[model samples]
Target: MLEDLLLQGAQPNYADNIRAIAARWEALIPPARLGDLESGDLQAGIVSILESGEVTDDVILTIAGDLASLSWWRGPPLRDDHRARLNALTRARLTRLADSLEMAPRKLPRSQLRRSHVLLVGNLLDPLHSPSGGAIDYAAALASDTAVSRVEIVHSGEVLPAMRTYIEARLGGFPASRGVALVSTRDNPDFLADILSRGPCTFHVWCEPALSPAISLVSRLGPTLMFTCADEAPVQFADVYWYFQSEAHIEKVWKAHAAPQEFIDRYVRILALPSPEPRPLEPMSRASIGLPEDAFVIATVGNRLGVEMDEAYITGIELALRSQPKAVWMVVGGLPDYLLGAFEQVLGDRFLHVPFSRELDRLMTTVDLFANPFRAGGGNSANIAVGAGAAVLSLSRGDVSSLVPDSFIASDPEEYFRYLGFLMDSPELLAAVKAEQGQHNARMRDQGLFLKEIQGLVRLAADRYEARGCGAPLSTTVFAPLTRLAQAG
Candidate 1:
């Protein structure tokens, strides 16, 4: 019997290996007779051969289960159990595989990404599913470009227990491969170890201003690329030709001195939503949210999160409520806690809160009026706000006011209340304003060509990487003054 020879220690795949011989015979023998094989010379042969090779009882039990049920060869039928086993096996093999293959991890060159794999590192302004997470959205577009072969992401914002936990969370259940690397800020030295010892490439993508010790590590690592969107001047960081829903922002950047003359000369990009045939405003839906049947709806969405210059948002809301007792104010998007707390103390009962939704295009249909109480920030959310067919009452904060024209710009609560109340009281005025907005929205739709310009900037980054290899770290010092010039200009 093979058991005698297995006792002399033969490898599993060898002809003399009792385990292989038992497997061969077990497959040949009938299912009902497999029970007999378990106890007789055949079974003993398998056990003695397995024991000689130091295979545990677990192995023999597995073989027995396979012969009995004919399912062991296929792994656990339940997906979760199967996946867990797979992950365990993968982890067990990684170190041995690395050692046996002598596959040393490669470092990302400091200069450029040309043919190298690039990992986008940043906090998702919205989850991956949201259309607005520009990082992911742009990355998806870049996937079709041949310049990139591999794109991995390291979402460090999702806090985890350790570097391993962080990597595991981000790996999103994919098996690790040699082409992917974790782009991290240096605060995670252990992650750095994991990279140098086991990774294929590494780079740090700095997403914020204000250098932290973590980012300084990128400077030490020679070939890292640092990118940030926090430049004071929009054109300094973004292409001047980017698509804007509002021409006001596009023009503002064009006039700003911080933008390169080269950019200004060719800045014709503006992305506009398609303009569908206009329709009459849908019937008032206020009755659904507990607004009185007679109450008029006035809605607004903007940087209600917080801005020291714009503390009059709550004041404007109170003014609207006082001016029109039957007015229901629906606010969408994030609101600052302090403002919310204050509003709750004053007019919380009269206000309805709806978090920001991509469905704004549809939700705008139900509103009767839109009031923008922004007292600061020159760039307005009015473009899209107006696109929804709502007449806007905005603060004429410099160039941002051009986002909506023939609209009231109120400096105080009294002025805000006056225009908002007038619009509600006069249906004729509201109708005229809404009609004008429809025309403007159509004009804006023509600006959709601007998105290609944004794509052009990304392409520029990709091309530079290819031509020069990863080059020296750009001088962060030079961009600071440029941002200041943009603000003054």
Candidate 2:
């Protein structure tokens, strides 16, 4: 069969395979570095892999897996079974590779054993660069962990000048040797390959459409445990998922999406990540964003990052804005032109756009209330609003419930509308809700919820490591002894 394909120029030789792989691999690597692959270097490398006298199944399998992962961003484009074939090969060859290439205990110093190396593949790298609050905060929390030895951030796209400074201070400032590497998947995906190739320690991901390739590829390589922070439960690719709300709500969402009950039971990890308590949001007014002093500001967050929005949602906002004349909808963050235009048209001068800010926590305090963005949902935006002591109102429930005030959770659309109208009619009712929310916010911050979740994740990851029989590993968890390290500057 191989001979026949070659006869008709179906494959031709190893060079064709390398070329085809390299073309698709463009998506995975830095655009600038891609020239070398097309200049015959990639094929030459492939030749060496095939001709090396000491080649093992692991060597071939690694190449196959890389190509498969690069090509199958979603699952093969059409009939290209490259992903499936490579996955099977990698799994078959993994044990042999893991056993032979395992890092020795003696070689690792005692200090190294105290911490776990975490490779984070997500949108975080710099505040000025991506300005994504969720990823940046999550990375900050993990980096602050005393038990974390190395936190390698795998980011993509532009790295502005400000990004470098932010990383150096927040992430790279860690005391651990080789503490942080702000890696670009485009510039050097090799660092990621090197880590995963070393054997599946674990891959933690925030499941977004953009990361489908990375997540799918990681699934192919060995016995890797993937912990995902996904608002919606994925049908495949992730191993364990961290959901930011109650089990009942998540179960309802999963079942609504047709996720099997067994799958949900096996994979979901209900972890209501705690709110980040920065210094309390300083006082500001409607004048901060060019609105009237008495404008009843309704705050919301948005981004061009493809947050889900529907027409019904547009109607909800339209109704919210029209319900009261003083209602000014202040959106903080970038929005698609269409949505932005819709808001602008509906509210005219009453709509305010504050370009996404790093200090959004402080800015959110300026608003009267944070209306959870209809069906789109909020990430750090909702958290900051609630943490800043502003009441949050959500029409549709999902993970957004984790951050919103209990006094403001609307049961259905009719009730949601009624609540909005009631609040618009009665100033006392709105102020009381906001006050109750402030009390709850104070309690949440005092309890340290976000930090606790990170600590819990470290403990869980450590448990998996020890159970793997990978020597009696020091717990990569925060114990009494490690408390000093946690408090260490």
Which candidate number maximizes TM-score? 2
For every candidate in turn, the CA RMSD to the true structure comes to 23.6, 13.0
TM-score of each: 0.45, 0.62
lDDT of 1: 0.43
lDDT of 1 at 476: 21
Tens digits of per-residue lDDT, candidate 1, 200-235, equal: 332434333211222323322323333322111221
- Candidate 2 residue lDDT tens string, 79-158: 21322333323332332222333343322233333343444445444553223334545566666666665655666667
| Model 2 TM | 0.62
- Model 1 segments more than 4 A misplaced: 1-121, 125-132, 141-154, 159-231, 234-284, 300-311, 332-350, 353-365, 375-391, 396-422, 432-451, 458-489
Tell me the whole-model lDDT of each prediction, alpha carbons only. Answer: 0.43, 0.51
Candidate 2 residue pairs in backbone clash: 30-186, 274-450
* Best-performing candidate as measured by lDDT: 2
